[model samples]
Target: MDNLTLVIALAAVAVAGILFFINRRPARQTAVETVSHRRYAGAHREQARPAADADPQTRFVETSKPKQYRLLNSSEQELYHRLCEAMPNMRVFTQVGVSQLALARGRQEAMRLSRMAGRGVDFVVCDADFSIVAAIELAWPTTGQEIDNAEDVKRVALQSLGIPMIVFRPNKLPDADTISREIADAILRRNRLEAERS
Candidate 1:
């Protein structure tokens, strides 16, 4: 071949080699990456899967029914019956959530209220119209430190909402008449305070 043809042929061969190298390098790298990814994925699956011979009982299974129990103890039951008898016209709800009794003004207040979701009054007294009259907490004669702290938090939250909370010790169970009178008085006082605000 002439010098120009020979140069062109050499150039073409170099270009082909360069292209082949470039393409082959990425293909090899990709193949390695694919193999590594598969291995990593297999390891993750092995870790996530239970052993083939694992016990059926050892596996976690959700139940349609959750564990059930009585909401109140014997003493609480006695107090609940008495309160019901005392206010025949009113509705007495057991384990009433504090959120139901209080109104949140904004998102911040609502989130704060959500934290109080599980904390509830032992008994909630409502009028015939379902307007909350007052909240009653059965304070045991012997209260644990944790219980006392929780009660204090509940008291503060109720007070902030302008709701009256009546704590009664089982040892000193008040007469139905006395409870009814106190509830009536509290309702009147609350009405007066709300009226003044308006």
Candidate 2:
């Protein structure tokens, strides 16, 4: 054979040898993976899907039943009534969001607004002109210290925007007369502070 023929034959032989080696090698086995409870639940749910052609048991039955719940519990309801009685001249709103009373400003407006949006006052007292006066938080007798700390954070955030937070324990609620006086005092104190700052 010519030199070119010899080179071609040698190349063909090398290619065949590589193919034979590849065919004779044992197939690699992938390790068995351990599935966690969470993952197994997800996989089982995926595998247990009903067939498309299978009949649905309750084709005409309505499964979603939504029920209404009271916005305030018994303690909160009592406080709401007391607030209304004490501040009859003013408007009292329940479950009020902090964002409604204070707006975020400056460079971090969105971030600040989001933080305020997540926090809310149990009750809000507003003047005749609809300006917010004070925020009231009713601390339940059975609450933990974490709730108290969270309330403190809310108080500081509201105070920063010139709004005062009044905390009243449900079990130790003051009478209407006392409540009215406390609100007046808080408003007066806030005004004095603002005047001094100005």
Alpha-carbon lDDT, every model? 0.80, 0.77
What is the C-alpha lDDT profile of model 2 across 109-144, one tens digit per residue?
435656767678898888898776788999865468
Worst 10 residues of 1 by lDDT: 101-110
**How far off is residue 137 in model 1, in Å?**
0.4
Q: For candidate 2, which ten residues in a row score worst on lDDT?
A: 26-35
Q: Runs in model 2 with CA error above 4 Å?
A: 1-68, 104-113, 141-144, 196-198
Check candidate 1 and list the clashing pairs.
Answer: none
Instruction: Give the candidate number with the greatest TM-score.
Output: 2
Candidate 2 similarity to native, TM-score: 0.58
Candidate 1 has a TM-score of 0.56
